[model samples]
Target: MKEPYEKPLIKKVQVGLSNKFGSVYGRHLRPEIDGVPISDLVSRFGSPLFVFSERRLREKYRQIYQMFSTRYPNVQFSWSYKTNYLDAICAILHQEGETAEVVSEFEYEKARRLGVPGSEIIFNGPYKPLSALKTAVQEGAIINIDHFDEIYDLEEIAEELGQPIKVGIRLNMDTGISPQWTRFGFNLESGQALDAAKRLVSGGKLILNGLHCHLGTFLLEPRAYAKAIEKMVDFAYELEDNFDLKIEYLDIGGGFPSRNRLKGIYLSPEVAVPPLEDFAEAICDTLLSKLKPNDFPKLILETGRAIVDEAGFLITTVHASKRLPDGTRSYVVDAGVNILFTAFWYNFKIELEEDISGPAEPCVIYGPLCMNIDVVAENVQLPPLPRGTRLIFSPVGAYNVTQWMQFIRYRPAVVLVGEDGQVDVIREAENLNDVVDRERLPERLILKKS
Candidate 1:
């Protein structure tokens, strides 16, 4: 067999570059996932399928839990439901002794459905409506008040229930993060957090038992956590001195990053992202040093991406190839931003299904969406592979499933690959009925044909 011919062009070659497709060839050409062939998955589940490694998911949860548990005396991990709240994913973490961390009433109900007791749930996020607050208060869920309004709502709920409700106030501080996430919680530097604490104490209906703060997401610096912990601990001591509030816990909210490299990050994830060990050391060292030997509060981590990102993969097929007016090669794939929503931020690791031996060129990978922003990757090096060639995109297990939208095309099916090489469909692919199930046709608009 002869190789496909190409219109050759002159270009400068980079030093030490290999015949591989991309500079990230180390992660290129994944023909299989967890001993299951990509073709087999696509054939059974169809293209643009989402595959998860149950083994990797369990391993990540254990690894992070162990890292922090060994360093801190009482460390609790709360699985962030907003990350990937699929029952399958959540069940896996819950089975690993993780408590549920929900941001809304819907998530709270999901956790409860999974048999997570209300007392075991950590409720975070802004905009908890009256109904949500009422349910949370009655269920004994650990509620973190995000604003003064939520504080007021909870107090009313506590009074209505005729009981003392324990609550935590979310704080935002200048952890040296620019464009800081000051939107969610009370500000510590401006004394907003202290003021909120006073409100909780004076109100008498709510008890301030915990202190919570989430600096930002995709955090690369472990020292940032150390600083946040220091502030939170200091605030706890202040509460104890002035309001006699012995803070029961410190909820260091999750922002730990996955191995996926950010868009503007100059260094690779291996060098740019600090290891979990560094984070555990930074947080635990600060906690142990500040509190007394027996007075250390429960340290809770709400990590999401770091634990599940690497465990997910998306299998897409090349639908068509085109040469742009600028002579750049591009491909139209089945998966798009609608399902791979993180594509807007993360440039996932792209690999071919099989080895395509040819001169590689820089090309663009586009999704099936008609929108201009439906690009999967740009200027990625790849060989000129024909249509129907499957490509694997990975580390997409974090937010895609939760944040994905049902747009012009149907969302694909999701499968979980077990440790013994068995496969199970966790989510079925969407169909016309699934899309139009809730839609209703007006009586006047109904058409009758002969």
Candidate 2:
């Protein structure tokens, strides 16, 4: 026998949810099962923490490598140290067989510390201190000399060391780009590059092994690279004809764009602004069509941004929400311009990790910095979020890490999420003692305290 039961009525609640960035999880961002949510990660590591996705990093790196290797036979990527320079990140790249590209003395030492052999490192920059030149020469690193001053300095250093150092000259070709060839390297059109090469060969103090040209960074047009490659090949031929020197490599400096959208420009993901395939095709086709089989030099790329941009994410907490005088909503977060310099140049897409029953609203995102210029996003469409809600900014893995300044506020710790989904703190958050360690107390100010 069974007892009789009564049914109870249940009420349903209406919720409003919308996808702002068109995240992969359909219309709503959800908490990743293993990657951890913005809120949970913040609760554990505090706000304004940087989280790196190992999956994304490896994927991007492989894509870049394949793009060039499939098209050209001899292709190598020298990871630009100035882009990120995190030992963990560089270690990952080096483990994947990528070489190191260093600019300064400190970065050269860092590369050496990372166990990157001097033969694998390519030293490129305009200003290399004498000490750096000496170390590079001793280690057999390929030194990319920038100007006449550098040439003289290196010649003197080589003479003093009693050994000829292998060097390359950075050629600045006029590709008719914006802001027009103002910094670094000798100009090709002005015959400065030719003159410099001739002088170096005639002086016999240094060995000229290659030609380097970095047209510009974040180059949007593939044709610019094609033109630059054509010019470089011609220069290589001229060097061979007159100086009887066989150039060993052609270093095409890195400026590849990431997936982030530039400010004031709206582009769909499918549009493909100078896709990786296009760059490979242009560079390979130009080199293959221009140079002979024996003249084929090792194609070296110093890419930083494109390799690591998609790997980084910044998770922050909403400090407050307010309405402007004109009826606009604004959300202030705990992170700011001190860490995210790319916000000035990129329209960083921000998204919520949970479903919310609120209408979408236009808002300005502000950081916790005291300066008025600490805004992260202006006129961004985001779902209505309450205080303490978490927001995630994507595609910030490149310049932000190296360029971030500890201005007005201390920077946050950086964590590298391993491929196995384990989080490791690569850099710890700065503290008062960390800053004070570099500061010395004046003897006059050191008085006995009562």
Candidate 3:
């Protein structure tokens, strides 16, 4: 009989390195995740699994929180729910003391169901319906107005409730980034932001207590934060001086990038993506200089990707291999864009779980999807991988789960690797019932058995 449990295997992988004497070369294998063997995890949880390290999750939150708090007084972080709202992920962050920052009604409800109070939630996004607004308002969530219509909508709500509502207005500005995110909020450079603020405060039914702006995502340049903070702080002071508004918080919304390299970037991720420390310095120095030393507004970071991306992993199995007409190697894996959606934007670092000895060759990695557009990586370096071989993808903790779709196949199970090496399944692998459960059929359309 086959063994009931698979023993941990020590595998070797080629890696480049230098010795202390100045010349050395060898192989390095990341054989396990938090000491849990990849094969063991697969055997227990099924294939195409997502693994999050609890230790890493806590480390990232503590790192970003410490970096900001030690530099500035009264720093708050709201976990961006749109990134990876898996209950396990959110619960861990909530345990670390992060409030929820949701963009939609579903996400808001998810946060509340997770035991986060309404007052602690930061409600944002452009598509909040009237019903959601009423719920958010009644629950005391920090509502950030996205468009001019939202102002009118909230004014009506305040009148209905017979109370003036406290709110924040989302602003968009050019922080020296390309194709400026002009679509989301009022533009600061065009004076539209100022006009909107004026209209809100003058309405008498709404109180503007906070300022918010989210520069685009995957931000590589740390200076963009400096520019955003400088502009927001100046505006906060102007509002205080002209309208006597007391700005309680300045939400420099999150766009902090992860280590994942984007396609077509000439520079490597290390050269392209600045460290978190650099971002903290850029943001804090500006806030420390621009605001009053004694009464600085609370600094709120609505960060998402940065906190969770590096803590996630996706383990997949290679089922088939082929050579393109052009002679490039191609391999198809069990997980596809339907599951690993970020594969479209990032060239993830892939590691082999089994020992494969050969010279590395340029290759293409494709998903199991039938669509031609389901390519994962254009051209990557990997040794020949046989059937049943496992590949581990790192830093996929951000938006994959939230954005992933249940297309041609059932979505995979997601598990959390605890600090003590205990593996717990957070999401189960989908079954046929899971796929058809929400679907309905008409009586006339139901076909009778032959």
| Predicted structure with the largest TM-score when compared to the true one | 1
Model 2 ranges with Cα > 4 A deviation: 1-30, 447-450
Off by over 4 Å in 3: 1-28
Local distance difference test values of all predictions, in order = 0.89, 0.83, 0.89
How close to the true structure is residue 36 of candidate 3, measured as C-alpha lDDT? Answer: 95
User: 1 or 2: which has the higher TM-score?
Assistant: 1
Off by over 4 Å in 1: 1-27
TM-score of each candidate structure, all chains considered together: 0.96, 0.91, 0.93
Question: Against the correct fold, how does model 2 do in TM-score?
Answer: 0.91
Q: Candidate 1 lDDT, tens digit per residue, 308-420?
A: 99999999999999778778889999999999999888777788999887667778999998899999988777887788999999899999999999999999999999989
| Per-residue accuracy of model 2 over 87-187 as CA lDDT, tens digit each | 99999999888999999988999999989999899998888988888888888888898999998999999899998888999988877677555488888
- Winner of 2 and 3 under TM-score: 3
Cα deviation at 303, candidate 1, in Å, is 0.5
For model 3, residues 165-258, the per-residue Cα lDDT tens digits are 9999899998889978888989999999999989997899999999999998998889999999999999988998999899999999999999
